[model samples]
Target: MSSLSRRKFLLTAGATAVGTAILHGCTSGGNAPQTPASPSTNASPAAGGEAPEVTKAKLGFIALTDAAPLIVAKEKGLFAKYGMTEVEVLKQASWPVTRDNLELGSGGGGIDGAHILTPMPYLMSLGTITKTKKPLPMYILARLNTQGQGISVANVYKELKVALDSKPLKEAFAKAKAGGKELKVAMTFPGGTHDLWMRYWLAAGGIVPGKDVSVIPVPPPQMVANMKVGNMESFCVGEPWNAQLVNQKLGYSALITGQLWKNHPEKAFGMRKDWVDQNPKAAQALLKAVLEAQQWCDDPANKEEMVKIISDRQYLKVPPKDILGRLQGKVDFGDGRTIDDPDLAMKFWRDNASYPYKSHDLWFLTEDIRWGYLPASTDTKKIIDEVNREDLWKQAAQAIGVPVEQIPTSSSRGVETFFDGVKFDPENPKAYLDSLKIKTIKA
Candidate 1:
């Protein structure tokens, strides 16, 4: 990408706000950092007041840059300020482990909530693709962040001159296949957003994920090391692993998820539904705290501080340097491409990033079915309403004093477009599914 004036970058980058008018430096490059002007010193009083039903709660998070909101909330005391005194933020090993811990509940020495994939709560709610056969009630109170995920290709692909166009990648895979080398690609989880993103990108290039190449599931933090040890040829995951791959010279990002779909929804603030039901006030308190921390995270000024804060041994467990570049939109596409536009940056609060739009969740659910992770006959509407806790988000939003004008009046954001120019209509998901030229499921 060219070095444009901040004003031009914001204008041409085209990451417009869907709901919030007060979008920060991300959408249009020229703007002041967004931070809460003031935070309360007062704590909620107990007994029939706004105090939490349960102050102690356990939240699980994977080691990625998007986990910043949960970490920042704890580190910055936003949780305590909201009267969630004994909140414990645990570092989880993988998505499967997080699900297991949530099933265990905090009292059983497991997590009550998590920094989770947007599609997971819906999947978990229906018992469609989880290890446990039993259905579990799940709710998405807020979105953790948008974009910031990437598809990193190994150094071997350098000879093929891999770019956004996957033709070379396909041809290279064919050549490797003829030579009896089985090419492989990996993502974080099945029926998860990362899996959908990788599948979409590959299918766009005429590479059928399950047929053209081997698809593997690896934890986010393990992506870099796995590729380094020759475990996989290419992988898609959220940062700082993608950035670390570039730093380690093992591979370069062929595409960021934002490039695939600008300001796309990523991780979310999801919890077991029964926990939220049993502790409604505690759920509200959790939302308020996470939202406050999200406001702090959207500020460009805090990106560096955030890198250091999450780099601690207990959080991301990686060097701060690997994370700072992508957060600042200084992307190294590892194959000799770079960009400096702030528009491609990860978002926590900007572009209504915190709102759990039902339309967005619908798209995820539809895509999961597209890949056959869920049955083609699955009812999306029922699952979305069951898993998305938008009402609770509104209650917390009111408590936080969000301007009345900024709150979204409806759940749907209307039609969503992709970098490849395909459009998804939430109202006509079946039509959208049928329109796809390459799909694991036939219409």
Candidate 2:
């Protein structure tokens, strides 16, 4: 059989096995507590519209600052305003935990949706990273935030002056390896956003990620503690953890990811496809609440209040100081370099940050293929169409009276140029793959 046909056969067979397992009371494991009961069919609708079929959903989020929109929506009663009074934004311990819970689903002790890494829904939908290898269909309702993630290096390499150019760090790793020490770098999860960023940064410096050094998974909240005990040399993750690392004097921020690719897409508001299909009106209500929260978060005047709310013990649980500076676009790299550029801050609504661009999804799938995470013959467009729910976003936007000018006219964001002068044109993904100097897959 051809490679593509073999892959298709495996996926189909695996799904059938998973279905049998579910029927026999065997399912993926997770410790997530049972969520509130599913939305009631009799719940009253909000003013001026038909009531949502369900008025409740359980959504998971990590402690990263990018999750602020979800936090804000719940904390500020935006969800209630949209008639979703029982929305629960629970905290997830790690990306893998999030995946497991999603697979279990709300009825089965998992979540209905989450504030997640942009590439994760696609990964889960393909069954590439699921525990049962059963495709868990998902939808991308909105892009939660862009930029703000960071690549931080332990103080051991502080003198190397490693920033965007990773050559200095590469030599240090090589020297350590020669002396019988195998250097390890960490990201939030394999084939996720942070993994792609860390890999791209290393590859751009002519260093092969998996061959020259070991790349491992480290949860975002554990990054600093792990580095302090000399667990990993470096890590890529979203803010407040990176900011906390700098505040604790454990590491220095080498570069905010915006320096890698300006305003790159990051976290997403994603829901299980089953939940969306069963509760279309409730889904739109949830999207409207998050969209309003995103606008509120992007406003400069609300920055301080937003930080304080998300820093509460129930949410991020970190001090507001660690999250505020970076959230305000004031970055202290902890290595004698600082920049105050609001344009580089994490954006929730400005510059169309909330829109789920098909082009961005394509880039992520292409990157997954490049790293051998997905089959080379994977149908990128079909997957994007199946997962991205930008149409839902537009409908919600119009329902909420969003200015027509703010709505994007095209799905593609055009060609994106990375810091190293490499460009990714969604129109021709093969050309972008061929241009990479280091990769596991041949275009």
TM-score of each: 0.90, 0.90
Q: What does the lDDT come to for candidate 1?
A: 0.79
- Poorest 10 consecutive residues of model 1 by lDDT? 10-19
- For 1-443, candidate 1 gives per-residue lDDT tens digits of 12223211111000000011111111212223343433453655353477888888999999999999999989988898888989999998888888778778887889999999888777677865455667778899998988999998998788776666776788778888899986778888876878889989998888888888977777787777778866677888999999999999998888888888877899999999999999998888889999888888888877888889999999998888899999988998887789997778898887677888888888887787787666676767777777788889889877887766456667876677888899877777888889998887533
The residue pairs found clashing in candidate 2 are 45-51
TM-score of 1: 0.90
User: What is the lDDT, from 0 to 100, of the residue 211 in candidate 1?
Assistant: 81
The segments of candidate 1 whose C-alpha lies over 4 angstroms from its true place after superposition are 1-48
Question: Clash totals for all models, in order?
Answer: 1, 1
Q: How accurate is candidate 2 locally (lDDT)?
A: 0.83
Off by over 4 Å in 2: 1-45
lDDT of 2 by residue, 246-361 (tens): 99999999999988998789999999999999999999989988988888888888889999999998889999999999998899999999999988999888778888888888
